[model samples]
Target chain A: MPDATQSMEAIEQPAVIKRGSRFSGYLRAISAMVWKDLTAELRSRELLSAMLVFALLVILIFNFALELDIRTRETVTSGVLWVTFAFAGTLGLNRSMAVERDRGCLDGLLLVPVDRSALYFGKVLGNLIFMLIVEAIILPVYSLLYDVNLFHPGLMAVILLGSVGYVAVGTLLSTMAVQARTRDVLLPILLFPVVLPLLVAALKASNGFLQGFNMEEIWPWVYLLIAYDVIFIAVAFMVFDFVVEE
Target chain B: MTHSSDRRLTPCGVKMIETQRLVKTFGLKPVLRGIDFSVEYGEFVALVGPNGAGKTTFLRILATLSRPSMGEVRVAGHLLPAQATAVRRCLGVVTHQPLLYGDMTVDENLRFYGRMYGVRNLQQRIEDVLEMVGLMALRRDRVRQFSRGMQQRLSIGRAILHDPGILLFDEPYTGLDQEAAAMLDTLLRDVADRGRTVVMTSHDLTRVTDLADRVDILHKGEIAASVRRGEVDLAELPALYFSVTHA
Candidate 1:
């Protein structure tokens, strides 16, 4: 019984190294990883191009279906914006992690001497950047098309907070989905359900800001978004090492 | 370039890789029953085996890619499944996959690895590795545009870019033609001559016979036989291998 217990303990022991003495080095590795993904996308433009076109198409469909008159636009604007970001963000996350798995780049990254959390943060940051770029372009277009000013600072803050929460969970889930046999259909099924609460909070906060709600009225949703981002980012960092290990 | 002589040394002064009863299983199936293997520093050892002989599994364990079900595996004094990051610092691996980003150029690929290793003077080091693998002329070419041979050469550059103390190669010559194969042989010989601990898994018996100082037969998940290169004649290896395994 003692021998069996010892074996179980050994098997369950974590493989993560403590983040000490090389925090600066890990930071540099994280930046290098972010740069790697950006350059790869710059050359191919495959991931971004697909995501942008898909996002524009989804918005176009929404415009037609809702007969987006001024009253309809005002009421549905926040829902439209969050929906576009959520759907498109999933597309980008799926492709980014899939590229790493398909090209064997993930294994290459693992073989490096750097900490695995560095890799996780690098990926999260990269995916977040991609989501932001798409959101940035879409915001102006949505404003021009609907004749509604979408550049409110509060709205932008809500977008950033919501994107952080969405991407943190999406990156973790996408890495898992990419390894599955049915990755194409698997990501949304796995992601949308997990991010349901984040979507609710982001939508509520974004709408509150767009409608000129005071801080006292919107404080609860803001707190929820912040709490979601912090909790998931921490959880993702802790569990990401096992997800990528072979 | 000065070799592992300047690298950290264990108290005993001998750099070695040792495994005690390493075992790996996939669900109900046992791949590595029990593996007891060791290689000294500066020795170029080759692992040869049939298709399902578990050579890849064993090498993967040493590379810290796969964990052992139960055993003590140590590389250069760091125990694995626990001290993986420490072990990774001193190891280099070349797998069947090129592991290069296809859209990125050769320079971009090596630059990424150099940053990960936190290599000093990264630009100069990148230039040196490119020249070492004879990819200087094609440094700006996308990896997807290169042929199988060129990609393999660039991969060799990637593996050695970090100047690791221990190197692992898994069937590196799988897709190379005669000329490309010869180029790789020269590079491997140069690396081994520089006194790095080298372990390679290969099915090409004739080539490994010439390059490896020692060859071990991995059959049924364990080392079946280990012999020095000097003792075996190049022509009689096949018959000898069959005879020993059957016996």
Candidate 2:
């Protein structure tokens, strides 16, 4: 213990305590948070596996129940894909925040000196990555099972845009819900209604791309998706500090 | 006994922590009523109280984990809620929960926190902190595999990783065995010896008497009594605590 005190002095008056500029520090904190989440998930495999399995199950169930012919599958592919993504995304968002809450790591994150929004953005980025990964895997599988081409460029763009909007709002809502005992059920109840506008836009744009509709036909929904993504991201950034505050 | 109005400052005339008329409520129920509290630089003040006395609430507010419903709170000379980021940079907090990631190894946990704090020369600092907490041998082990004592020790390492000037600990000894608690005592002394102001909340009277330079009793959301070391005999602390809290 005496030696501990001696070493403590070394930390107390380091010859040089090099901290990055504020902007760099903020970026570093965000990246660090993302890295922590990714690393933890890599080890546990709990969050991604659950989301992927759930996503696959949803696709399989839709395949059997809808039993769509090729013509009908083309029309319904967008709807089915969006539903699968939304449900899987909700699972990922809920589990991610729950891990933080259960382990008291959320408080640990809040204690950092960076703007609380940095934490919010970091979680958002992490959740977006997980959702994209799940979607990437689900895309080819859904195509195989339903025998429909699901990889149009415009459809990809819609997927990315939709994911951004969904995750941005889901991340914020999950932060709020994680504080509640009924968080598992609370997130979807809060998220689906709030995210409905963006989801509708995504579904429309995706359908237009699949149906080979002209740019003029798809432009409005694309614009709506873009608008919703930006607005939700900005809103989440502004209110995240208040949402996480106890 | 020091009253809330006394406002005792360190020899250098600085209050490391000060709160005036701090009030906190949860929904409709009040947790912390109008209360004033302060700690000087390098002082170790143990806040003892019965359950629901608002000791955790008070420490959480100082740690900036909870917003005081109403108060003028300052830490390390910076007003809180306004300069909270500045205050956070100067504070290291250890609550009852370890606040560590289970899947991450001890080394990775420190590295992650090091990055979050933007601590320079992080590798060397992590090594030093691991050594200080006596967890150097288990650096690569997953935190979930650790015993309760080991996790608490790592929690201390995480708290001190950034070398903050003030530490707020809430029931750090909870769930620790006799040996682990003694080890924590040594660490606490070493920390205080390094000139960091500390405010700790504990239910253990004997341990508080041994480690705290001053003891403040909180009862029903307010300071019921306060006494510096040597002002009261160590043997009578339990009696003092009971009389204050039960009164």
Candidate 3:
């Protein structure tokens, strides 16, 4: 059914496809990054296992280090949980980015035909997934140990907000940190400072909900969390091209 | 002037990477100073330079990993700066590190990159590349466990899995033992035979003399000499390379 001359031309000197016009190319690029990170994680269990073990260990140490009385638990729960998450998030982010840099996979990925934002999303999603898996594992374990049901609807929302915030800034900062001479140690130092807004908002929201605060008491924190997530994600998306550019 | 037609003989029926007056500087030290170069669709061109001659800088520019301070670069007609994303869509890169996740199995790494490159039928492509690299059996093993040579083999597999029309290698064969290097050489030749353009940077002139269709000497941030493969005797090349850089 094909035209003979056109087919011959295709065989002799095939035409290359343009990176599709429209947002579809952007969507495709994003999916490519996400798919790449998730598949790699699924195969190796590298980042997840490391984060999970680290999270559990943090909770265990917190149990001994901090008094478990009801009053102390109420005030410290959100702070304690987010701190653990922040710490664990860095562990996964730094390790993953460092691995990419050390192995020279970053170079290969950069050579791909996609916008650099795709790389940012791919790494962020991968890191977020790893952090969430750790959180999921930690929640039940912490619930059993602390006699608190961490599966509250509000808490889940807070975790999602916190993670989105953490991942957004963490991905961007980690990209920069990985390129520096100080790689592994540099990620947390860099990530924690930029992500304070996300941390504060999520922590406040999480704690307020846990203490059964009124709607008026909780709305401010929730607003802050949403604003933090959206703003940082956008900033991260914009700056990604510069960071990945050689 | 007569040799200009000879330059056109290679099968890169269309140019893969073409640059005009490309300039890049870092920390106020200019690396590529208003340089112009092009690699045809299937041409095997070696960017030969001493340490700090800006070979890597130029390759990075073409790869869209770095931007030039100024100039025009077109990768397969994808106008650079404005259309780097478009240019990146068609190119493939193999660098010194292999750039794979060490904790993941080889299959996972390949599948991830295949998706990143938007390669259709990713599984089939991964299988074909693995088989080509002779790493089909080790697909389940984590890359962290592989030796330096084995890792490089997988790196090559990752780069070629997408079947990019343009393949850029930054000292890809540097760390390999002889047998592995030979395998890499044969694979590169096979890729070239299929009409893929390749631009590689290397320090070893003996190997470059044997492998490159043409060679360009980059010295002190500019191309100092350009020679066809058969023109150079190996003994005189180091002197030429050193003198160019020094000059």
Candidate 4:
């Protein structure tokens, strides 16, 4: 009974240091994951390079397939952007996670002290950064070719919302996909369906803005994108502890 | 939530790992049953058994990498399930998976885990770990460029960056060449020398005898047998295991 009591006490207060300062500790953990990912990307540059090139190729193909004459460009630009993002986001997400899982880095991360949710955030941030970087370049290139300015603040906001939602689901799905025998081919198939709502909102909202639709017209899509981002990120955080457990 | 020891305890000092009748299974299958185990502050213990034994499950449970069906598990004196995060903080685990982002560089991989573990002086810590794993020069190289052994070495670096009080190796030696494995052995010993505990799961009995302070044979989902080096009969393990497994 005494040992049992001790054991119970042990569980309740495992860390002698009450996480010191709660918010600081959580932020530190989250930032650390993000910083590591960013630095790693800075060094290799391969992940970003591949994502950019693939995104460009996707835009190129869409250009020919959709036959974007001047009149059609306005209607198609937003759709084209989401299509490129959805495709390119998968490239970044899959390679980002598969590399970790294949090289034993995931096991290494699991061994450490920070919360597992910190990891989920770190990867999501890392993937988002990469996706945004690719989009930054794609938007400029497309604007030069099609004469449509995608630099509008509202459109940028939409991109943020869509990217967050895209990555939330992507990160979770990638975790599972990488563990399967068919990792390389499985990521996109799993990701696309999961990110469909994000795709819908992004496509419609982006188009609404690009096509000169009013705030009232764009608000619903924007709201959906925001809600999607928040919901999945929360779900991902809750489920991450289970998925990453050995 | 129940005891003083379990409440806000210092992981800086303790026996490192302790479990009481740790029980676990996959679905209906019992992988570990009523297994009581513990390791001293700086001891190295080997978990040995044939394929499908509970070796991995035991490590997973101890590492808080997996949940047990029943029983108690503690690491660095942190009670499990309740203090799994605390246990994770003090314990470092390296499994067969590399777990690094291939899209990132070797430098980035080490740096990321260092931060995730919330180590202080992260840059210096990353440098120290990179040196420990002998990957400082290659840190800028993308993970895709690394060979299996190089990646495995980096995996070790990632696990130890936070200076865990307890370390776990689950088939960590798989795919590691002799040189890499030897380096890992030396690293493991050095880690233990720092008053940290090390628990490793492996199939190589001879190596376990060579390195471990004690050895436990896991058969089926239970601890088939456990003993110190001399007490483990070299010639009889196969037959002993067969009987334990059969029983």
Can you write out model 1's per-residue Cα lDDT over B1-247, one digit (the tens) per residue?
1223223222222445889999999998889988888887667789988888898999999988889998899987789979888788778788888889999999999988888777777788889889988999999999999888888888888888877767899998898899989888888877777656789999998888877767898888888888775476645767767876676
Let me know the TM-score candidate 3 reaches against the reference structure: 0.87
The residue-by-residue lDDT of candidate 1 on A138-222, one tens digit each, is 9988887788888888889999999999999999998888878998899999999989999999898888888888888888998
The C-alpha stretches of model 2 lying farther than 4 A from their native spots are A1-17, B1-11
Residues B33-74 of candidate 3: C-alpha lDDT, one tens digit per residue: 989898765578889988888988898888888888989998
lDDT of each: 0.83, 0.88, 0.78, 0.75
lDDT of 1 at B242: 83
Q: Please, what are the lDDT tens digits per residue for candidate 3 over residues A1-246?
A: 233344324322224333345466567767766776776677667778888889999988988888678777767888879988998888888877866776777777777666778778877877787888888888888877676767789889989988988888988988888888888688878877788878888888898888889979888989998898898899888889888776
Count of backbone clashes for each model? 0, 0, 8, 26
**Candidate 4 chain B: worst-modelled 10 consecutive residues by lDDT:** B1-10
**Judged by DockQ relative to the true structure, which candidate is superior, 2 or 4?**
2
Docking class of 2: acceptable
Model 1 TM: 0.92
Best by TM-score: 2
Q: Can you write out model 4's per-residue Cα lDDT over B1-247, one digit (the tens) per residue?
A: 1112222222332456788988786778777878888776556788888898878878878877677778987776567888776676666677887777776777766666655554567787778888887888987888878877787788778777766656788887888788877777666666555544678999776566666767788876667787764575555655665676677
- DockQ for every model, please: 0.30, 0.43, 0.43, 0.35
On lDDT, the leading prediction is: 2
The segments of candidate 4 whose C-alpha lies over 4 angstroms from its true place after superposition are: A1-20, A182-186, B1-15, B96-109, B122-157, B176-184, B229-247
Q: On residues B1-247, what C-alpha lDDT tens digit does candidate 2 reach at each position?
A: 2222123223243577899999999998999998898887667899999999999999999999899899799887779889899888888999999999999999999999989988888999999999999999999999999988889999999999988878999999999999999899888877777767889999998888888888999999999999888777766889888888777
What fraction of the native alpha-carbon contacts across the interface, defined at 8 angstroms, is recovered by model 3?
0.50
- Candidate structures ordered by TM-score, highest first: 2, 1, 3, 4
lDDT of 2 by residue, A131-203 (tens): 9999999999998999998878889999999999999999999999999889889999999999999999999
